[model samples]
Target: MLIYHPAFDANHCLYRIVSILHSANKTGVSWSLLRLLDFYYLFPAQLKEISPWPSQISKYKRLLKNIPQQYEDINNSPRVFYDLEKFQKTAVLELIAKGIVSKESFEADKLCLVDDALPPSFIAYMKSDEFFNKDEFKIITEALPMVGLNGPQGLKKRSGLMEYIYDA
Candidate 1:
């Protein structure tokens, strides 16, 4: 069986993380793809800048502390995307804006992989022992598949794609 190491392949890690978050959240209330990217790339300092209010910062900090196992930050700086060649930031933004999955999504979900932002295999691998603990796997596996073929919608519009996603 193939195993994914986030330290070795951060791009795949980001992709998988986004898909997992999207799948795990309930339908119609799923996090936007931009939000997932922020969760992965935005450092604590960046978060602080955006969350000026103490209560908001505290709430976001708590949320960050509870991120999935694969995303646990040990060092001071939070991990950020460094896969500009294989996974260009621009391309990913386009994907989120257009709901177009990369060719890699085919490896994650054969059917509707190109159309939907989240794929079945992405969730499956995340739930596998390769990344998550048994309890985490069980919870993630159970919740991720409750919805089908759902993609992240534009945070502004509430339903369809947004023409532009503001740069962070």
Candidate 2:
């Protein structure tokens, strides 16, 4: 749903998605940055905000190949469905601070696993109450195209300024 928000900042988007991964419980899969980018832009809404330049997209793909994806190694898998620690990066943890990385874990220096699943908490947070409702859906649907995810135009539609933008 994030592709075309017009206001989509790649760093912010990746940061949020990474935060979601930190909370997941799955152990069998890992998210390649390229794969995650495709997933985000895979949806219609996500691309609406993305620049169409191939070079820009490729630059991000290159980062996935080079950046560190794993936050830490699992000592014992959590029984819970979401293993929130999986996706935490040093920067993100510092930003929110539940307690910085386990000092022991850092000194232990074990092999870390990359998180594959997206966080449900974030997905739910992104969804709207009017999501499946017909009337609101109609309004949002009608609103997306005026600027196609590029700026204040998309924001206006999502925000209650659609009429103003359209009429202006």
Candidate 3:
């Protein structure tokens, strides 16, 4: 069984945190992408700069606990491409502006892996509960079928998800 430790820069991480806030607020959000939503919905207000850690920690943490599926495939790129297209330019630009991330990697949803594990506690600090747990919005978790996944034995091969061993 493979355990996934979502990285700080991962779209899923932001989505998990933001969606929890949206759900708390009862906001009708059906989209899978969020960084764009963060810019459109939380930025300018500087919600991303939430001090002392984002206040939405508990909520985001709760939403993050929902991931248990291991099903994956090679075509997982579409979900990220279409869902995050709007934010691709903006988020990457912001990262570049902040010097937090490199620009070369932002052109595509080209996913990466975090070698070291990260706990969710630090994530709560990115924004305040106001944006993380907004009362009017709600969040839903989505997966990119093959995000950062390597074929069996790390070989350049694709295999059936049914063969995946849970708790491996």
**Whose lDDT is greatest here?**
1
- Provide the lDDT at 17 for model 2: 41
Return the lDDT, model 3, position 63. 42
Least well predicted 10-residue stretch by lDDT in candidate 3? 154-163
Candidate 1: regions farther than 4 A off = 1-14, 17-21, 24-49, 53-61, 64-86, 90-122, 129-168
Q: Number of clashing residue pairs in every model?
A: 0, 13, 16
Candidates, ranked, lDDT = 1, 3, 2
| For every candidate, C-alpha RMSD to the true structure in Å | 10.7, 19.2, 16.5
Q: How many backbone clashes does candidate 1 have?
A: 0
Off by over 4 Å in 3: 1-91, 102-104, 110-124, 135-168
lDDT of 3 at 70: 33
lDDT of 1 by residue, 69-155 (tens): 444443533233323223434444445455544444423432122444456685676556343453333233332233221323222
TM-score of each: 0.31, 0.21, 0.25
Query: Candidate 3: lDDT of 145?
Result: 19
- What lDDT would each prediction earn against the true structure? 0.37, 0.31, 0.33
